[model samples]
Target chain A: MNLKFKHKEVRVFAPASVANVSCGFDVMGFAMGTPGDEIVVRRSDKNTVTIKSITGDEGVLPHDARKNTASVAVQKFLEHVGFESGVEIEVHKQMPLGSGLGSSAASSAGAVLAINRLLGEPFSRKELLPFAAEGERVACGTAHYDNVGPSLLGGFVFIRSTEPLDIFGLPFPESLHGVVVHPHIEIKTEDTRKILRNDIQLGQAVKQWGNVGGLVAGLINKDIDLISRSMEDVVIEPIRSVLIPGYDSVKESALAEGAIGAGIAGSGPSIFALTPGEESARRVCRAMKSRLDDIGLPSDEYISQINTKGAQVIDVKD
Target chain B: MNLKFKHKEVRVFAPASVANVSCGFDVMGFAMGTPGDEIVVRRSDKNTVTIKSITGDEGVLPHDARKNTASVAVQKFLEHVGFESGVEIEVHKQMPLGSGLGSSAASSAGAVLAINRLLGEPFSRKELLPFAAEGERVACGTAHYDNVGPSLLGGFVFIRSTEPLDIFGLPFPESLHGVVVHPHIEIKTEDTRKILRNDIQLGQAVKQWGNVGGLVAGLINKDIDLISRSMEDVVIEPIRSVLIPGYDSVKESALAEGAIGAGIAGSGPSIFALTPGEESARRVCRAMKSRLDDIGLPSDEYISQINTKGAQVIDVKD
Candidate 1:
C-alpha cells in the first residue's frame, strides 16, 4: 500500500501565541513573529491518517492521529470537510515544549492550514479556527481557543466566547513590541489549570473585569500608558504565578525598567513584558531575563512586533 | 447677608447616566438625554461653602456643603484649584431621587463643571472626573467613577481605576439608541449594595470578564450583533436583579421584542435596554413598559439616542 501522497501536498506556518496577555486570561491572545511551528500535509493512498515526523518535541508527542494534537486537528479538518482520504502529516516544532508559548496550539494551527490547503482550500483562515481548537481538547484536558484563535487569525485576538465560538481580531497597538522570556524550566499546563480556585472573591473579580475592559480600551485607543495600567491580572495570576519560580521578582523587574506591563505568559514558567518600541522591549527583556538568572534559572528571550499575519501558506504543491 | 451669589455664576447641565450597564458593575457608564440634574455654582462673599437651595429632591438632601454631594464636589474643585473663595450651589434634581439614574453623580458632575467654568476653566473636563467621583463618596458608601466619568466626559466612558484616576472615553456606536424603563418604586443604592455577596464563583467571574471585554470591542467596532451577544451579566445581574420587581420578566420581554440587552439600570427600580435603532428602542420600551403595566407597577419610559455630549453649558456666564 502506498503511504505517501499521489501528488497533492502543502506546507503551512503557524506562529506561537501568548495567551491571556496578562489581564485577559482564557479570553485574549496575540501572535509573535518567531519561534513558531510548521506542518506539511499530503493526500495519501492509505485510508488512515499517519504522522510521518515531529521535530523539536523530543519525540514525546504521540504519532497516532487520534492521540496527537496536530494530527487530531487534521482529523477534525477531514471530518469537517467530509474528506475520507488518508493524510500524512509532518510537524516541525520551532518552539520548545512547555515553554508557555502555545507550542501545542502552533502545531495544531499549522496542521490545519496544511490539511486545508491539501484539500483544495475548502475553508477560509477564520473557518479553520474550530478545527484547530478541537486540537486543544486533545492537547489539554479541556478545549479553549485563546491560543489557537490568535495563532490562526493573527493580531490581537479576543475570544469573546468559546461555547458559541465567537472570536475576532483586535487592533495591535502601533510601535508595540513583545518581550517574552522563557525560563529554562518545565511546567505542565494541566498543573497550572488545576491550581486555580473554583471560587473567587467578588472584589477580585471586579478588579479583573476592570482590567480586561481597560486593556481592550487601551489597545483600541493606542494608549500605551493605559495598557501599562490595565495589564493587571488579579484572579489567575496570583494563584498560577505561585507555581512559577521568580514570578514576582521578574514582573517587578520589568515594571521597574519602564516596561508597560509584565506578567506570566500562558500557564507558567515563561514571563512576558510589553514595551512601546524595540529599545524599551530589549531593555525590558534584559531586565526580566536577568532577574530570572538571579534565581538560578537561565532563560531564552525573544523580541518581535505583534504578528499581523497569523497562519500562512509558505508553500503549496499540486 | 445675602446667601446667593453677588455677581458671578455658572450653570451646567449634567445628563442622567446608566451605571453598571448590565455587565460592567461599578466600572462602566453611558449618558442619556433629558430628565437630568441642573447645578448652579456662584461666587460667594464668605470663605465657606453652602447650598443656597435644593429643588426636585423634596429638600431632603443635606444642606451642609461638606455633606451634600453637589457642594462637596464644589469644595473639591476649589481645593484642587487652590481657590480660597466660598461658593454657593443650587441643585435642581430633574430626575427623581433614588431613580437608579445616577442622580447624585449628575448633581456632582454639574457642580464641578459649573464651578470650573466659573473659575475661568482652571481644569479640563477630563480633569474634573476625580472631583465628581469624590462627590460620589459623599453620596454612596464608596467612591466610584463609572457614573461620574460618563456624566462628565460623555459618550461611553470606561472607569479604569479610581486611584490616581485613569479614565478614557470609548467611541460610541452610531445609530445606537437607549431604551430605559424606570418604575415608580424607589430602591436606595445603599440597600442594593448591602444585598450583594462578597464572593463570586470563578466560572461566573470569567463569564463576566469575557462579556465586558466583548462589549468594549463591540462598541469600538460598532458591531451591534456582537454587542447583543456580549451583554450577558453573570455575577451582578442575577444577584442585583432579584431586588427589582419583575426584573426577569421585563428582561425576557425586552429580548423577545428585539432589544439588544437589558438589566437593572444602576442599583434597582430602573431597568435600561439597548437597541440598534430608534424604532427597536421604541418597540423595546413599549414591551418593557407593558410588562411593568401587567405587574401593577407604573413606569416612566424614555427613548433617546445614546447621548454623545455629556454635560454641556446651556449658559456660560463670563
Candidate 2:
C-alpha cells in the first residue's frame, strides 16, 4: 500500500502574552500581536527530537533539541499521547526574554500547536496546555500557565484549574485596546520569583480576590467602569514595580494619557496600559515610551488590540 | 377646606444568608428560605428610629433602636437618603446568630428594603447594600459584603468589587440542593477573624484562587462536575473547621451520601452539605446530623433549594 501525504509542514504563529494581568495576579492572562514568536515544525524520519534551525536570537538560545522550547514541548506532547515518533522543530525567537513580552511562552505555544497539527491533531488545545507549561519550566524553572494559556489559546484567558486541568477562555470585551512598553533590560523569572514574598497578609489576600472577582465580572459583563475600578494590586505589583525603571512614572503617565489602568507586565522590567480606544492606546504608547526614554532607556512599544486568535497553523508547506 | 392624611406601612422580608461558601472564602455567598428575618416599617409623624418588637432571640437581643439590627439599618437609610420623617421598625429575628446563618444580615437587609419602599423607593438595591453592610457591622464589627449582598439581592451572589460597588448575582444551577446542620453552638465572626493567620503561603493562595475560578466557571456554565471538583479549601475552612465538632467526620459522611461538597458553615458551629437532588440532600443531611450526633453534638438541620428571591416589602398586618 502506498500512502501519500500533503500539507506535511506547518508554520505556527503564537502571539505574545501578558501574564498576571494586574488584578488576576497569577490566573488572568491575554495575548497581543506585533511582538510574538514563530515556530515551524516538519514531519521527519529522525529517531530523536531535532532542532533544524534557529533565527532572531542573538546567538544566545540553545539549538539542542532538549533545550529548545518548541522541541521540549513536542517531546512532552509525545509523552502525553503515548506517541513514539520523531519530528524536527525550528524556533524563531522574535520576542526577547525579560522584555515581558512572553518570549518563552510564545515559542512553547507555537511549537506545540504546530507539531500537534503535524501529528493529525490528536490532542485538544486545552490538553496541549500542560505540555506548553512544561516547556515553560525549561525557561523559568517553574511551569506557569498564565502566559502559556493565552499564547496558545489567544484572547482573555482565566486558568480555572491547573490540576485535574481546567481552563476558561473568557470573552474579550469589545473596544479594548492596550499599550505594552518593553524597556531593554534583563530580569529572569527566577530572580523575579525570589523577590516576591513567600507569604501575604490575609487582608491583602481578601483584596486580591475582590479584584479578581471584579475583573472577571467586568470582562464578562462588558462593564468598562468596573474594569477600570478593579485593576489594582495591593499585594505584588507594589513590590515588583520597583524592578523596572520609571515604572511608577510610566504607569502614572499612561493613566494620565487616557489609559484607564496600568500595571507591571508579568514579573517585569516591562509594563502594560489598558485604554478604552485606539486613540487612547496610541496616546498611552507615546506616554509609556517617553517615560522610559526620560530614564535613559531604549524602549520598544506596541499598541495593539487583544489578540482573539491564540495559536494557529497559518501556513503549510509540504 | 378639609385635608385628610393617610399613612401606609411597608414590610419587607430578607432571607438569612451563608457567605464564603466552602472554598469561596470571600467571594461566594447565597441566601436561604424559611428561616429568615422580617421587618415591618410603619410611617410615623415623629422623627425617630424605633424598634417596636422582636422574636426568636430568646429575649437576649437589645430593644433600643440604636442597638437593634433592623432599626440601625433603617436609621442609616433614612439619614443617607435624607428622609425627615420617623419610621417604626419591627424585627422578627427568626434565624439564630452565630450559627453561620447570617442572622444579622437578614435583619439589616430587611430593614433597608422595607425603608426603601416606605420612602417610595429612593435608591437601587445596589445602593442599599452598604447600608445593610453598615447594619451588619453592628454584629460583625467590619463591613464585609459577602453576607449583605446575598441577603439583599438573593440567588447565588459573587461580590465582584466593593470599592466602586460591583456586585453580580450569578445564575443558580438547576437541581442544586443544600443541607444545613447547625450544632447549636456559638461561633462569632470576631472569633473566626481572630483565628485566621495574618499571613498565608503564596502556594496556598494560588490554590485558593484556582478553586474560586473553578467555582465561578461552574456557576456560569452550570457544570456540576466542575462545581464538585472545585469544592476545596486550603485557607479558611481548614483552620476554622478545627473549631467545629465532628466537622471532618460530618463532611466525609455527607460526601459519601451523594453530597457534591460539605464544609464548616461560615466560620464554625454550623456545617453545610451540597447535593444534586432533594433525596440526596435529605440523605446527606441525615448522614451529617448522625455523624455529629455520634460525636455528642446533635444539630438542627434544613434541606432546601437555593433561594432565588431576595428582600422585598411585605404587609404583615394583612
| Model 1, C-alpha of A200: deviation from truth (Å) | 1.5
Q: Listing every candidate in turn, what is its Cα RMSD in Å to the true structure after a full C-alpha superposition?
A: 3.1, 3.1
Tens digit of lDDT per residue, candidate 1, span A217-261? Answer: 889888887888899998898888888888999999989888989
Residues B1-318 of candidate 1: C-alpha lDDT, one tens digit per residue: 112232388888998889988888878889988668988888888898899999888878999888999999889877766678797888888987788888899999999888878776767899888889889999996878888888888888887767667777888677888888999987888888888998888878878889999999898888888889988898888888887889899999999999889888888689999988999998899999999999999988888888898998777554
- DockQ per model, Cα: 0.78, 0.58
lDDT of 1 at B92: 89
Best by TM-score: 1
Highest lDDT, which number?
1
Compared with the true structure, what per-residue lDDT tens digits does model 2 show for residues B148-266?
88889887888765665678887758788878899977777788889899999987887777677667767777878878887888899889988887788999999999998888767
* Number of backbone clashes in candidate 1: 0
What clash pairs does model 1 have?
none
Steric clash pairs (candidate 2): A154-A310, B11-B314
Q: Report how far off residue A206 is in candidate 2 (Å).
A: 0.5
**Per-residue lDDT for A9 in model 2?**
86
Tell me the spans in candidate 1 whose CA falls farther than 4 Å from its real position: A1-7, B1-7, B316-318
Q: Which runs in model 2 stand beyond 4 Å of their true positions?
A: A1-8, A80-85, B1-6, B44-46, B82-84, B316-318
